[model samples]
Target: MTMKGLYNSFMYAARAHAKWEIETSFNIIKNRKQLLILFIMALPLLIPAMAHAADFIGGKSAFGPSFFSPTTFYGSIAVGVVAGLITGCIGAGGGFVITPALMSLGVKGILAVGTDMFHIFAKAIMGTTLHKKMGNVHAGLAIAFLIGSGLGVTGGGMINRALFNYNPVMSDLLISSVYVILLGFLGFFALSEYIGMRKKSPKGGDAHGGPDEMTALGAKLQSINLAPMIKFDEHVVPGGRRISGIFVAICGSVTGFLASILGVGGGFVTFPMFVYGLGISTGTTVGTDILQIIFTAGYGSIAQYAIYGYVFYTLAMGMLLGSLFGIQVGAITTKVVPGTQIKAFYALAILAGFVNRLFALPEKLAQMNYITLVPSTAAIITKIGVWLFFGLVSIFAFWIIGTFIANIPKLRAESGYDVEDTKGGVSQ
Candidate 1:
């Protein structure tokens, strides 16, 4: 496939995943049972607050100040809001920015990964409505995938912890290096696509430019009669298509490993792997991806990170709250914004993240004594990256909010609500 085709496929998958996340978040908010569960999960925050009180009263406390802080709490919410805005407006998974944003806020890389995983886990649990999509799911395929993913999650978690124990700087370096590579590749392609669209049409084209076709690799894999074949897409084609369970498991393993290491819930990777690599029908891919996220994120967070004291519950909750609000606003704002502008922002946002991680590398390298550099110079570079990233994100957020506010009258009118102007305020 050509580079452009590959990029389109990636965007299509990412958009689908983002839509699921947004819908799930909204459902969780509207469901009383889910809200209650969320409340129960947040009850743990009281423990940290109580500990803080004890320390304030001149008593010893096991919980450190790091466990709960006002600044970090609010900062996490802001990070989540920005991520949600990108996801909602750009129609792609905004999760790519979460870890880097956390790291920029002085969060430990491992802790950030763990916290993000927990956030995704909480969202998945509250938002999952598998019964609705069960018809699209292939039981045999999901089972094989989960088995491999379990093993992959375990291995990935171990690697991260081992690096952290050996040298915290090394752990940060690994995580930063991974983001740099990923964001750089995605960002470059995204920018290229944006430029291509501008040249082709004054208005931006659809984010997903074309339909996905089965790849040559996928065709070859399906033809192989490896043991334990999985049948799927009976609804789509006669006799349905079958691929080896082994291949499904392999794809699951890669997805799990990346999810554990990056704390992205793996949905972004799962979609492409299933649709493009394995040639699964999109219906099956979507249903199966949702199931895999709940399991992969839950297992990776609780089994690997939470139990190890790496997960920050407060931050996770804060982000969840912020993203819920942000996603709604962003989705609505997209109605008024031009598609081309949204595409440009998406490319810029990814590039900003790439720059943030890339520049921060020098500081980690300097601390590890891997490179000779002045500490001040390293700090300056890192600061520049942080400013550039947050600056772009802030601008996007403001624009979305501004558009939403400005278009409120029109939005209200469309929704059959009348707006009345008062002396100093407007009421709907």
Candidate 2:
């Protein structure tokens, strides 16, 4: 063939090859979407099983304050680091883990909670700093929430002390009741918000009113002269700046009190309050919640050092290792999962936890007539039940993680393409 003809033939072959590659890419994309859906469907089953297997509770080494001893203090630091690492990785404050771990080590519930607070404070600060860098955290909102949260902690602490002195059992029950209530309300509220968002979407005119509703509520509040209205991107208010100050102080006091009393980081409540009541975005809410917890938890940890001094270094270190990787994995996963889905799942989880707390485990166990059953059979059944619950959870978690990992490349590609297409559309 002539040189020009030969070049033409080569071009034709290249075009055919390119078309084949495109077809293959399209097929891969289709398969990935299916995989993603399947993965999500499997998560609920997996998460519970993982929770059982993960040994989320029951550690004697985590029970008490050993901060008086350098060894214990150092050990607690290690534990805090591990727990903090997990919080960082999982997008949680790790108060759940730290408190339980401390309790297992013989730490009094009150002191363990205080120590956990200190740890949360430290980790939250770090997480907040990262979020701030990423521009996900709203400084104005965070400062506002901090004010309320700090006051809440202090108030909660005082209330706890008074109640404990008056009647420890009643105090415990009261706190538990509050937790149950908070959990229930939060779950319901979050679910409602999620539903409202869905309804407001273009698919439903009735549901499509979230922003309008938010605006209307904001306007009403602004008209009330609530004081200290710090305007961020969302709303402009007459006195929005002052709102977070007093409210945050109140929240802080209550949160502190709760931490001192029940040993929880209050993230669950705080997250909802910021989003619904505070009117901040979800990302900002999560970022701010983590930040505030760090400071509050830090103070609690220091107090532990001065008084009871119980910190388990070994356990903390181990936890830190596990949690650090988990956070990165979770953060990345968040990108793939729709925000609405994440919120709904979180709400459901909170609601479930609330329901679980309403019924006492020990009491239920006592009520069961296992004594009348065959000893060997009963023992086998119990062991199987425990293992099955956790083992399945682990498998499900692994499945979700694996699916997320598999789809990450696809998500990034799609996102990048969308951005380019949007830019191109705008330019034209």
Candidate 3:
């Protein structure tokens, strides 16, 4: 496919995934049951606090050493807030930056990945109401997909663990390399899209518009009448479409593998693969993606990472809490910000993450002896990457929060709420 076509596909997928995440965040916070469950899950962390503040902050005990330093605790929340802001404002998946941000904050690459997975799982469990959306789900298709995803998760987890056991540097190298490849393509395209939009429309409207059409590849895939065909979209298409279960399973495997290795929950890619590759209708794709993410994230985090002790429950909970608030504020701020600016910031944020991971490579390479370099010089480069990444994200977060605060009166007026009356505790 052409670069522009690829970018469009990517954005479509990301927006769909972001929509789910935003909804999930809202649901988790709004529902008392979910809030109670979340609180219960977090109670164990407080047990450490009873001993001594210092004892809880990276202290060792019979159970294990805590990774609960104040810096890391608050830092993880900051990371989640920034990510949530990007997702809410840009209308695209902000999760791409989470693992990179954590790694930059001195988290072990494996631990970062595992913790991210757990965070996603927690969000999915608390926020996703699959029963309400199951009308659009094709049970057979979901089953086939999960079957393949399960195997993929296993393989990916084994690969990461094996690398870590062999050499921690190697594991970091692998994860960083993956991000470099993904973010490099995405960042370059995002920047290009921003420039193109600026030229076409001074004040950009919607970044993506137009109907979702089946791609040529999607058509070809659907034509393959292998046995055990999984039919779907009967509600949208007259006769509905059928694709081989094998192809569906293959797509699931790819999604699961990426989720396992990257901790992104694989929702970003699932939409594109279903809509563009498998010829699935957007309606069906949406519900199925939701169902799958819960399973994929839960299985990957608990079965693959948590059991092995890679998942950081404290960091996961902190991110969950921060993202809930950040998404709401960022979503509100979108009413005040221009689409062009939002798109531009999204591109810059992604490119910042790209630069961060890309520059950190030298240090990993030097440690692994893959490249000879002065240790001090390598450290400096790594520090530059970390500072640049965090600096850009922090600025974006502040800008969004500032915009939200400044626009409260306007937003309230638009919502037909009297600002003066609210100050007096009246709702006239």
Cα lDDT of model 2 by residue, 219-272, tens digit:
444345455655554433343322434444454555555555555555545533
Q: Judged by TM-score relative to the true structure, which candidate is superior, 1 or 2?
A: 1
Give the range of the ten consecutive residues with the poorest summed lDDT in model 2. Answer: 13-22
Give per-candidate clash totals: 0, 91, 0
Candidate 2 — number of clashing residue pairs? Answer: 91
Tens digit of lDDT per residue, candidate 1, span 42-76? 56455776534433211122111233457777889
> Candidate 2 — which residues are off by over 4 angstroms?
1-112, 115-118, 125-151, 158-176, 184-248, 255-291, 304-306, 310-314, 333-356, 359-396, 402-428
- Sort by lDDT, best first: 3, 1, 2
**TM per model?**
0.90, 0.50, 0.90
- Which ranges of candidate 3 are over 4 A from the true structure? 45-68, 202-213, 417-428
Clashing pairs in 3: none
What TM-score does model 2 achieve against the real structure?
0.50
Q: Candidate 2, after superposition: displacement of residue 208 in Å?
A: 12
